[model samples]
Target: MVKQQQGAGHSAEASALGFYYQAFFALLTLMRQDTDNAAVGIEQLDDVDLKVDGHNLLYQLKHSTSDAPPVISLKSKALWKTVKVWVDILPDLTLSETTLHLVTVAKLGLDSPLIALTNLEAERTELVEAMVEEAQRVLDARAAASKMGKALPHADRVDGCSAFLSLTDTERLNLMRRTVIQPGSAAVGAIEDNVAGHLKLLPPEQRPAVAMRLVEWWDRQIIYSLCGKRERVIARGELQHQISAIVSDIEHDKLVPDFEIASPPRDYQPDGMLARQIQLVDGKTSDFSKAIREEWKAREQRSKWLNGSPAMAVTINDYDLVLEEHWSDRHSQMVEECAELDQKGKCQSGLEIMRWTHENAPSTVRPIAQGWGAAYYIRGSYQVLAIDLKVGWHSDYAKLLGDAE
Candidate 1:
């Protein structure tokens, strides 16, 4: 039993270290995306995994080597600790910009329904219930242990207990929502792949040498500190400094001037079709610009339909009419279906209409609609009829698409 526990401990430690390495690269990739002067660190005294500019993001990364997926429960010790950390930081000014994110390489535990929660109201209720339960559990356990002269499993029980009790319902909900879950191995894979792009973004002339240097520098300075081999504690700020130093040296010795870096030319529009289409429709770019400015001025009046009944359903046919006029596939089955639906007066009504659209609409439209979180189709004919049939439909469609809620 003792040997097995020790082996398990080693495995967990190794898994955590692997996640940190990936997370470090992920943070680095995000940091290099812009010219913003920011600081990022790991295992900082602030209980934050990454801090950039004024915003702090805390990530609790989890992975399982077993066939079964790793699970994180709201009632778990790990979650309570995370909550405690946020509570401790709440009074600090960074609290406004700080966010707590949970990144895991597996699905959440079955007991945690918070994963499926989407409605803001429902999420708030659940978070409040969970927070209250966890606070009671921890405080009770700590009190019992103290009375028995026994040591509890968690440290900082005194401060954590106080902070947990002190947090209001609104504060708890805000913190809970900020605790985003990045599920599955896909999240880690995305980070690793994106880091490759960041590496490619390095000056083309010194790319290979600079890439090799970064790898060596990270291995020498960062990896040891992360894995707990180094005796003295190294804050993330120190790690950031070391990285900047290495990159600076490489640039000074082997790279060209910052001004010489190739950049996309101004007004270097990529879409020839859009440019020509706008010119043909509005007669000039100035008219196109004026149209956009006028639309911004009357956005509220134009979006009145969105404020109507949530039950009001917008069918694929309605979306097609609004969106497919300029579509390329004029004679496709999708175009035929749109024509058929328009003749049948098939505004959003039931599953049959949904099934028809799902089956017949172009492969592209259905997914885009589904991404807008349309579980069932609603009749949006009223909205379609009210809007300017020629040009305003496009703006209305854009507005509806933006209203993901």
Candidate 2:
């Protein structure tokens, strides 16, 4: 039982690794495409594949973990299954323009009949004939086995071979001419290196980091498209634009404000330290809600920055100190001007301070990153400070909260 469970666990791990390989290969394909308008889709039109520049380019990716590469023989299930998919969809494709690719980490032996398919100069008619002959042989063997009352497994492979032989000579020739067998393709790790190589616009030290970020973004985009959360295709131009933006941010030493649309949980309540600080200024329920959201965004962005790099962490700390000093100066001035006023008047002054902080503080205090102009970041950072009791909107907030020390 334990052995069985261990085998299952190993199988599951290999399956997941294969999926990651497919996704990374898709990223490599998108990076290598010549046309900017070409779009890529995963598990859509093909496995780890899609259309490029109005021409269908379907790919079947096969990943292997063996020390010695597997051979893709004529009767290989991977080869036949790939052919089956193309045959089933042949009617919907423009045979003249559509290209089918069987990309695998496996190797094709020198004497394998499928090796001819990889040669563009190979005679299409001869290749088609060879494939048809192989398909017929498989069917004939299956028939002989059935006559002996013996059942052969892999019905899917048999069905695929039969379907290939059922096509007309001309159709088979066309499909053979369009098909390409790319065996011994790069493994998962090599493919990642290839992806990083394409990021020549980025510095050598930054290429891996940028490539990782690009692939992560691509994975999310693929998931969103697959889940119907967005369009089903990701254009090459979109990918190029993303790369350019990431490079620009790195070059300019600017941080990307990635949490603009981030929010707190749906059931989030305004009852924290930040909320109480707002309430001390007689803030409304709406103000409390907005403050909570701003604080959440700020904290999330800060966490991301801290995880990004030591430089980013230092930048955040410096920015926070600047904010604290700015708020202290403003708070001192507000307290002096409203010191002679009644308690009700002081409350009104506190409300005015809160309004100014929200409306004008961002403009006065520049963002830590030069290119980032998101005003909400500044407002949210103030809320974060308020939450930590470092800053507050009310003139006597420290005394009111019993934290004057």
- Highest lDDT model number: 2
Model 2 clash pairs? none
What's the TM-score of each model vs. the native? Answer: 0.41, 0.68
Candidate 1: residue 393 lDDT (0-100): 18
Instruction: Encode model 2's per-residue lDDT on 75-137: one tens digit a residue.
Output: 777777778888998878887778888887878888877888787567777667777887888
Highest TM-score model number: 2
Candidate 1 differs from the real structure by a C-alpha RMSD in angstroms, to one decimal, of 23.8
Q: Give the clash total for candidate 2.
A: 0
Model 1 earns a TM-score of: 0.41
Please, what are the lDDT tens digits per residue for candidate 1 over residues 192-295? 34443466545655555555445545544444666676632334455456556656765553221111112334453332322232232222455334323322
TM-score (C-alpha, index-matched) for candidate 2? 0.68
Worst 10 residues of 1 by lDDT: 375-384
Q: What is the C-alpha lDDT of each candidate?
A: 0.44, 0.77
**C-alpha positional error of residue 165 in candidate 1 after TM-score superposition, expressed in Å:** 2.8
Colliding pairs, model 1: 313-378, 313-379, 314-378
